[model samples]
Target: MVFHLFGLRALEVWLYSRLIRSPIFHQMVGRVHRRVEQIRHGIPPEESRTKLEGSGSLDKFVRYFKEEIQDQMKGKPRNKL
Candidate 1:
């Protein structure tokens, strides 16, 4: 039973790793992120859709992820107990 559980966990991890590594997955995540941001900024849904549709380049996607990571790191308190 323990071995079976471990095998299942390993398989889950492998599947998640592959999914995360896929470019299509990144593109989908990027789209969702942009949509959320636009909504948060009070952009109308139609306008947001148009803006998102115009900005799906690979370079923009990479830069977006990089900026998101930097923004996240900036918000953390440096010295946790």
Candidate 2:
């Protein structure tokens, strides 16, 4: 049975909110978050060596990755990932 918003009770909302905040939910979310981050990023470095960002963190990473790839293709010889 679906409970419409207008007819929902306080107890229902309270229970739902509690379940959302539970540690189990957080752990599942953390796993998904890490997997997604790894996919978007090539791999997790042992230690990140980065300077302070000025509003273009993702753009900088993308550009640097692309440049490194292009340099390798041109036989410039860079770090092997």
Candidate 3:
């Protein structure tokens, strides 16, 4: 999700709420899908992949909840979750 769709070559910020059913759809139909479309329209590639070596959205959420718990334990902000 991060590398190809939002590598440094593409926009940094995106609307996370907009979920698509397929990477193929984004590659085919999205605005500025140059990286994906050009190859299919021009030349066939021998390899396709999405890298799985990265922290996911669930990892972020877990980190948040853990920090919130730690903050409450430390009596920070005077609010509990």
Candidate 4:
């Protein structure tokens, strides 16, 4: 049973890797990211839907995610060791 579960997990990882490398996957992520940005910026959902047609590269998505994370981190108080 353990071996079977491990095999399934390995297959999932392989499939995920391939999916991320595909242009289609990146494009889909890009679209989602753009829609999220529009909503975050207070754009009306009706307008955002029409503006969802745009291109996004994996690099841009990664950078945007990183920036968001950093900004969130900056707003919280950190404990010093």
Candidate 5:
């Protein structure tokens, strides 16, 4: 639930950026996604890969939720220094 909230927040922010015509915001969103992919691949944390083998929507949602939350929290806000 928390993770979904985080991803939803990010999606909202990105949509807002698109409305505002900010290329920078789009770039920020891309960076966030890349970080999530890196985490899932265990680039730094070195987590073992698990194969779910064609799971349901809930399974996909949970994994995506976790990755989005982790990525967003670690990312720097666009207006920050």
Candidate 6:
């Protein structure tokens, strides 16, 4: 799931914001949270190194995942399940 969609930066940010709650924290805190998320989630160093790797840009990844989710919903009809 992480590879085909939900790319590194988005995953890292989700983990960080879900785990941390300090409005007055320093920038270093945010960086540390991101690193911690990456380590905890076992994201490869090379994979997390950039938003653009191979042919998939971050925007493209997000758009693809959104479309995939929409298609899945259309097929499964969430309330039916």
Best by lDDT: 1
Model 5 — TM-score against the truth?
Answer: 0.29
> Sorted on TM-score, highest at the top, how do the candidates line up?
1, 4, 2, 5, 3, 6
Tens-digit lDDT track for model 3 on 1-81?
668765744443333323355576576665456547766688544354554446785687789889888888988844544
- Give candidate 5's whole-model lDDT: 0.76
| Winning model by TM-score | 1
lDDT of 6 by residue, 1-81 (tens): 767565887888987896676555666786788789889999754444545676658778899778779979889634422
Candidate 2 collision pairs:
none
Judge candidate 2 at residue 34 and give its lDDT: 76
Give the lDDT of residue 77 in candidate 1: 38
Q: Each model's TM-score?
A: 0.52, 0.39, 0.28, 0.48, 0.29, 0.27
Q: How far is candidate 5 from the true structure (C-alpha RMSD, Å)?
A: 22.5
RMSD values for the candidates in order, in angstroms, are 14.9, 11.1, 18.6, 15.1, 22.5, 19.9
Q: Which residue segments of model 3 deviate by more than 4 Å? A: 1-55, 78-81
lDDT of 4: 0.79
Point out the higher-scoring one by lDDT: 4 or 6.
4
User: What would the per-residue lDDT of candidate 4 be over residues 26-64, giving only the tens digit for each residue?
Assistant: 989988987898789987555433443446655676887
lDDT (Cα atoms) of all candidates against the true structure: 0.80, 0.79, 0.62, 0.79, 0.76, 0.72
Query: Residue 25's C-alpha lDDT in candidate 6?
Result: 63
lDDT of 1 by residue, 1-81 (tens): 999999999999999999999999999998898799878998765544335444467678889778777777899534423
Greater-TM-score candidate between 1 and 4 = 1
List residue ranges in candidate 1 displaced over 4 A: 44-81
